[model samples]
Target: MQALTYLEEYHSFKEAALNSRFLKHKTIQQLIKKLPEAFEQRCIGQSHEGRDINLIQWGNGSIKVFLWSQMHGDEATGTMALFDLFNFLQLPQFQEISSLLAKSCTLYLLPMVNPDGAERFVRRNAQQIDINRDFNHQVSPEARLLKNTRAEINPHFGFNLHDQSTLWSVKKTGKPATLSYLAPAFDEALSVNEVRQNAMLVIAQMYKYLNPLLPQQIGLFDDEYEARAFGDNFQAAGTSTILIEAGGMFGDEEKQEIRKYFFLSILSGLYAISTRNYVEEPLQHYFSIPKNNKEIFHILIKNLLHQDIRVSIGLSYEEEPAEQGYATVKTYTIKDIGDLDHLGAYHIYKEETLQIEGPIDIYQPANFTLKKDNMILLSFKNGILQSKL
Candidate 1:
């Protein structure tokens, strides 16, 4: 209920400092230093590159809830939402929900778990290890620190936040999976114990509240068991782990809009736990949520002449960090060619008489110009979008 209210007034608490997805360790540190006295902030450990991994603690209730984000430096959406939640918790305007959370739950937030990877805007740490997959081995210091922190807290609930590929779409709706949730499976058989089931119930509650706003854009992430992933292990260790992934939106490239929904999701989940209302949610609702599928593309071109045959083309971009991680360079490539008529795309061009001025090669960089009536409509040079005239 409060979440819906917060949705209308999210701008008041949104973290303006983290307006972009290219968040660095220093930027977050400066923001952390400015947190109100209500939040207890400390340096929990150092990253592989000597960046301080900080933990901000709030509330003092019996329910221990641990939320961590940016395990993959590139997935900064969750960290931004966490900061927004921090602002929400500090504001007196929403003191009713704040009071409820403070009285019913204790929140431990670890933002930017992989600062080194974030520094380069890459998915892996400086040692080239995926921290999430290093759980069983503990080879990376960051992974070790995360594991030790979880063991120390032994939290009742865990929120594993990350971003997913923009190409993932909701089944049947053809809408981008802007946000996805999953109750990670602990075992190989994907069995549901009380711990895992509680997570599903919380996700169901979150879905019930979020679906109205997001519609078919919200989807359930795959539940395959990952033995080396933190969420699965945390669930096996008795913490009901809920995974929230921020995916793509049509025009919200920086995820500024998606971050709001992500923030509300966490708030809604917290509301469910604080009020103990998730138990009333039926298990069927969780299963009923749409599963993610790769039925979307960054750009789709249809009814274009290619070798005298009409075809549809799907283009996807590969992003590389640039300018010391301050920005990214996207190189669009022809991921699929032929019949992509059923798939959805962020940008689509479907003209009955469109001509291609260059070669169309599957799995190759996009290097062509699309024209209609001898007028250039779209142009790409070596995978870089040139112009839309």
Candidate 2:
């Protein structure tokens, strides 16, 4: 009955996380074609580029919940997690859990809210609009569709899912925040009303179940009020909206592990809501979770002297997203240079004395070279690193 044990059943998943990275519209359409007829689906709207924004509805219970993922299009972890849920519910072993959920809660899912952005594997749609930020303005068809769906369903619970940068960390823990949660503020004062408190309670339930598995990797996102964000607006409208940000793992560049955590988290939240398990929990637990801090780096270098002054550097990936018709490729580059003690790095390189060869181009790191006593320390070409150490 525990959520952790579900990991044993995940391997049997027909729609596995292993295949979900860089998922394009064609790939998703093919996968959804194989779903059982019981999971009802229909086009809620069309993207600016004419791609279908699909909604999959399930369950017949009194309380209803709505979940949407990849509104940013580049944030696909929760989308993969939903497909896993779709697969798990069909298996015989997990039928009771699914049935129990159905008896108490009805669920609606919008798996890909911005298919045009997903087609380009980018954050914005063809109109260059951010669907999440378009809530107030309804500038894009996707935003309008989400608003329409909310009005039609009137769901009691809303999960606003997204993927965060890989470098986010738990406050002062120096650990990459693997999974973070936020019960967003409905107003500028960031007050905790009943609906917002309910969302926080559910997040505490998730932390209770998953924190033991990840320890310091768990984080609480800042609850600053963003008036135009969908989660805040949804909470303002009385739905218990929870924001889930799937972040980085130490070595899991593809974030397959984080996707599994995403799946577990969703199931746990639904399980809590269906049974009213979070009704008695105090808000103290939610407030106790560490806040997510912005001080993690994928690469770090230390003590490279320039003009007799010591300097350190932090670099990041400048990814080149692939269109639906093209192969996916990501490149890393030197994004910044600083004494970044505030941030933690998964990889660190340090030395007493280092030398820079020729005139260095801060804007063009691809052709730069670092050397020490005739031995090349590192070289960058087209954002690819070559290390001689």
Candidate 3:
């Protein structure tokens, strides 16, 4: 029953979405104006381009939680999911959640942390410095604003949000990591202190809830301690920080489906934080989430009888901007050619008799056609490959 309610809430929110990929400062400004009287807005600081870095607050409880997304300009998935969360927060339909969240928590949201980078859809700020790695140096003004906000609020929990590449697959499964989470370690020791454990427990519950729906599509990020990262620094400052990376889903090119899981995790996290429901969760489940594996390819061809010998190849897609807008398309290249007896891919093809039709020049464009008995079976143009086999 609760799962159904969650789905219904997401549907209602998505149906009323005001913005998706083209979410800029003006869009956010106009959208927040329509928020119910419960929401309070403030200009925390200015970006490198003099854009207002805004903060929106709701609820009044002592369990203060701060969530910021799009620190990297190109990572827009979290920003979209946040607005979906905002829509759900305002609905009279979710009165029970509204009451529960309001009574026991204080939520602060900072979506689109790098508006300048978002404008260009680049990874860094306009200054070309990555905010996530600028904790001590303070190379960007946006970085300073986030540090100041953290100092001002002293939130009990911090959510360091961003989008990850679609190519990451679950270890040994070849399934895309639709969503990944991490409880940032507070120190180089990477020990699970009480504060860090709080984050793990909440994450464990989220993984438990999502595993049934997503199966092998979840992952645990490698916890190599980075002293300059916000999540690590926040954890060091005694704020339990959880990192959520929005990866790819099967056909969620716009990440609409992945956004639903993001919304669900946020809802579940708030409830767990408010109720301490995570305290009873097993820590092993947190570790059980597959470690982020970078070995997988987007597509693979195996067991093809080429010249009477089986051959396998791996192909990786590169993101290229589309003709006329902020939209982009993928262009694939042959990353490797070998006996890949172990690697997994979401899309795999097996052919009894296959021929890698010319011109098979390695430096040329990733264009090819597969033929069997003088008949074209598959053709890969640019990055998209369509196969009849």
Candidate 4:
């Protein structure tokens, strides 16, 4: 079947993921109401805010696949992909695949695991518990609901869905917008077990399908077994769980393009599990992509000398919540007197600087005091200059 296209035409991870016109609670309710009788919606539990935690179950296949998303409320990219998959399954063109899969295995989906967090665009629930890290305690309503739901379904294959920061790359060597996965380890020591190996086999096959499209942008996440993590708990329970972390599609202004890739990856994973098309060898190219790092700033001015002391200046961008129309810009403390390694190369002029004649509108650098006669201006892309009076 042709891959599902992203709903948005433009591609920005935050934009696409944050667009809730169709994925909101009301919209989801409407869609669920419209679903055919074959699909069943059950209230698994209540969230921290008393919102119903709903689960939609379809199909009667032997090999059950459980998929959940939005555990981190702000991480909505995977939730978008989940809805897209739902819509795809409902399409006429996908009927054959859907029907076939339905007859062979049950598909359970919890698209919005943290409704309260989603509303606030935060990572934690209303009580501030990270559901992902609450598995052991299961104190949070969302975590308890998930645990109960898992016990009820006892799915053979579990898909723990999430989105990662732009800093993440598949291999430490490739471009951004990479996809990553982890076959949940079965033991607390994170020992490689048969279930994990089987999950890896499917991941290897899925990599074959995604490599051509994503190239070096696909990677494996570290298989650390955290007692509170949902993936680890599920794996420890003997369910083969796959953690899909969508990450780093640079310049994907709307995240629409990345969403499509994520859709394709999901399809590939489903196919791998259903068909048992496990590849024996791991994808070595997975390690070719660069690891994600936060060392680089959004903007940087380099090669500046103050009082004969050479230093590098960096600026990082911060965005306000969606409610805030404009993003507040600020400068933060960064590494100084360092080489260009792991940093942007920007040159600054030794003589030119910013002049302050009156009260400043914004905070000035602590080290560089503003002078009325000295003018600060940026130099040819590489340097910052302080104009001498």
Candidate 5:
């Protein structure tokens, strides 16, 4: 019954979840068997593909908290965190939290809310409807199911969990990943209410628990009104809904570290809600951290072209599974322009060559001249040059 460190715990959980044989449907079933006492299975509705939407309910109390993750099937990071949190709740150390959760607050979780889309690793459901945007129309079965469930429970608080891409980072920051939250505006006026404030309070507390682990990687999401968004709908219903967006972290391509931070944040959030400690202010040290950004490239070359006409070039490489093995595609971007005096007055040229067995061929700018037989390279004597191969 030893406590596992954050990295060890999250890696273990991720490996198991990723290697599971079942799709979303079977995954939910397996989870129920793994934690039968803590999880009660209930039907939400059927997807466009006739898949039964599932719900797992734990704890029965007057104060209800609703948490739904993986509304976007391809966004599996938050869903994984939810599973880890469930496991933590079952631990002996969390017996008090578990007992209080059952007696004081009813925790309702719908993991992998979009099963049809989840199967194909898609953002939308089987009907091509973004569940988050379907709140207003209730056109998609997944959306309707969530709405109905919310009405039935009338939860006091709602956690809309999601994941964002690595391209997004805080403004003027270098952190690779950020955990952001938003207290959805109740109406079109964008006016803040007690419910919104309460959601912020909870978010601020969660930030406190996560900041030490993630530092400047925590952020606040912009609050905008989307009639169909789940958070907006829940906020309009007078429930304090907090939108948690798990984003990129530096050096964690798979986001395993960010996942662990999310698990701890959820635990802190639940603890705060149960104790009504929403007013507790986070440490100022959390604000001193910078945000995440996409400024860095995989490879950067400076003072090219004999160092005369200077230019800072950045090359980014992406690896994708291929029929044979893996294919690496290289993209080039001009990051900066250095001293132009060295090159007198020159122009930039690009050469591209494709080779199946050996290096690619090379061509001059505008394909006017064939420069070399193999290898892709860019020659910039003046101004700036950028291209991809």
Candidate 6:
């Protein structure tokens, strides 16, 4: 609950330097230089592209909480939230919470694990390897650094942070899954040991604190055991691991709004761990949280006459890094066509009298226009939205 109060003034402590979703290693390095002396900063390793991978450590208690973000370089929301957290921990007015954290837990943060991927704004590293999935092979330097660091620290808890697709929606709510939490299964049996259960209990506490602030917007991510992933392996290795994913918000294309909730989740989780309150939370609370599903689209147009048959069309965009990874180019594609009256979308268009100006085909790039009595409702040229009125 205190986290909520702190969230109201999020902009006060939010790292103003890192405002956009496209975060590069250089930007993070600059922010690191500005951090107060309380944080111990050092370069632990380098990416395949020879970019320095740094680690920042704060807090001093026996409880070791290790958090790593942006393993999939393009997933920068977690990295952004982490910077906000770094700023929050140092403010003078928040000594009550900050001192408690410092006295009860030691926080180890690797904000950006794949700087090379972040440089080009791609999912994988420069070696074209998914660092998260390269746990077994340990081929990539970033993966090796992460794995080795965890082993050296042997943390009591782990926070695996990443961003999920915007299309993910809360089951039954049909709203974009703005945030999702998961206690990854350590084994194929999906069994719940004390290790994983602690993670679940912590996640339940997180859900309790976050669900109200983001009502029906947070969902439980899929728990299918990922053999080579960091969360599952960390849980298997006896560290209670929690997976926090930043999904999407309706109007927040850059996820600036979502970042606040994401920061709150992390803060609440840490507070729970610090006070050992997660032990009081019921296991049922974790199961009761709704699961995420693909029940939403980026754009939806209903009652459109395609081939003389009225149908709904769902369109989603594929983001390609542009302007040297400083921006993105969204290419809209026809994702689905048919009865989608039950689905939700960030943008919806339903006019009683409308005309289709070009071909409407599923599984292809969007190249059509919707008009209502000479008024252009929506227009797309070769998958690019030209205008909407």
Q: What is the lDDT of residue 131 in candidate 4?
A: 93
What lDDT does the true structure give each of the candidates? 0.93, 0.83, 0.81, 0.64, 0.64, 0.92
Per-residue error (Å), model 3, residue 353: 3.3
lDDT of 6 by residue, 1-389 (tens): 48678878898889898889898899999998888888998899899989998888998999999999999989999999999999899888888998999999999999999999998899999999999899999999999999999999999999999999999999999799999999999999999999999999999999999988899999999999999998999999989999999999988999999999999999999999999999989999999999999999899999887788999999999999999888999999999999998999999988878788888877999999888898898899999989977
Candidates 3 and 4 compared by TM-score, better number: 3
Q: Pull out the clashing pairs in model 1.
A: none
Candidate 4 C-alpha error for residue 245, in Å: 1.3
TM-score of each: 0.98, 0.90, 0.92, 0.76, 0.74, 0.98
Tens-place lDDT per residue, model 1, 1-389, is 66578888998999888889998999999999998888999898999889999998999999999999999999999999999998898888889988999999999999989999999999999999999999999999999999999999999999999999998899988789999999999999999999999999999999999999999999999999989999999999999999999999989999999999999999999999999999999999999999999999888998777887788999999999999988999999999988887899998989888888987888999999999899999899999999876
Clashes of 5: 7
Model 4 regions lying over 4 Å from their true place? 1-23, 279-297, 300-337, 341-389
Name the candidate, 1 or 5, with the larger TM-score value: 1
- State residue 48's C-alpha deviation in candidate 1, in Å: 1.0
Superposition error at 273 for model 4 (Å): 0.7
Which model is ahead, 1 or 4, in terms of TM-score? Answer: 1
lDDT of 3 by residue, 1-389 (tens): 15446876567777345445545667777787777778888888899999888899999898999999999987887888788888887778788877888999999999878998887777889889999999999989999999989889999988888889888877877778889999988788899888899899999887877788788888998899998899999988888899999988776767878888887877778888888789899888788788879767776778765555677877777775453326667677877676887787656766666677644434345578877788887677765666545
How many steric overlaps are in each model, in order? Answer: 0, 1, 0, 39, 7, 0
Q: Higher TM-score: candidate 4 or 6?
A: 6
Better of 4 and 5 by TM-score: 4
Candidate 5: stretches off by over 4 Å: 1-15, 19-23, 282-308, 313-389
Q: Model 2, range 180-254, lDDT digits (tens) per residue?
A: 999999999999989999999999998998898788998999888888889999999989999999999988877
Better of 1 and 5 by lDDT: 1
Q: Model 6 clash pairs?
A: none
Q: Which should have the higher TM-score, number 2 or number 4?
A: 2
